[model samples]
Target: MEQDPITLIISLAGGILSFLLLMRFALQLSQADYYNPISQSVVRLTQPIVGPLQRVLRPKGRFDFATLIVALAVKAIAILVLIKMSPMFASAGGSISPLHLLIFSLAGTLNTLLTIYFWATLGAVIISWIAPDSYHPAPQLLLQLSEPLFALARKVIPPIGGLDLSPILIFLLIQIVQGYLSALVVI
Candidate 1:
């Protein structure tokens, strides 16, 4: 798991940017409070890139494809850079084919999105117990972002004894999907 400094920097920077852009996209889709400070920060941080793309992409309904596209591109480029720098890849004497890059890009993007949901759902569950009625933006945003997934889980496994078990199901589902993606991508 040794990484060169340059690779580490690229991965860290790209991951953060991708995560933020994904957050913006998710928040928009979830229709989270636009005025929430966290939402505003995500929007502001991503606007420079998403604003221009929005002009061409034109959002449809709650889906903001531009932000998602940018997030994918960022993750793709970072993976490409890291792959190019890897001695294992270099030693194989193989150039990165476009199709392989596309697969890796998609797998990486989906993985990041799932990771975001995983944490958001976990946070929302904790917040529900600690301060269910708190007006804090973080809890509110987490709850907003996670509600859809929670709803799905609730459908299959309703609350027992007035205790919701949806978060557990959602966590299991996320892990299963991530595992499948890892097996499919092989990178």
Candidate 2:
């Protein structure tokens, strides 16, 4: 079914905004320094949402998973709302059940998050290779963000001949998960 322009625009906007918000939250949760322009921008954009949640959740020490929860919740709500209202704004033909919409939004969110991670990792690898001694904030942030993912991947698939195949494996896994979730939404 073809989506209406208005609905398509709204959905796209919501998806992008939510992706940015979630990435900012993830960076903060990972304790990435706010010294770079990108980091500063993320902080400024996310403070309105994170500030209040931090006050309420008050994570005891270095671990603050609440921010992740809040970000995900906000993203999910925004996506769901956009999907729910899409028919009103756009001339879509297919009947989107609540369950289908929910599944689609959730899967889309996850897909976006993983894509962000992939990009960040790519950036870090590039920066590290080009200027090993460069004091760039993005590389550091990327390193911090990709560590856990890389670690998990390494555990499952060890490096071969000094080349890390973990990322490729993980990417394939993410693609499978995305495909499965997308199928749920359509079926």
Residue ranges of candidate 1 with Cα displaced over 4 Å: 91-94, 184-187
How do the residues 43-94 of candidate 2 rate in per-residue lDDT, one tens digit apiece?
6886787778888887655465555666556556666656556555456643
- The sequence of per-residue lDDT tens digits that candidate 1 reaches over residues 35-61 is 999999999989998888999998898
Predicted structure 2, TM vs. truth: 0.72
lDDT of model 1 at residue 83? 83
Tell me the TM-score of each prediction against the true structure: 0.93, 0.72
Give Cα distance to truth, residue 59, candidate 1, Å: 1.2
- Which residue segments of model 2 deviate by more than 4 Å? 1-5, 60-66, 88-104, 184-187
At residue 82, candidate 2 shows an lDDT of: 63
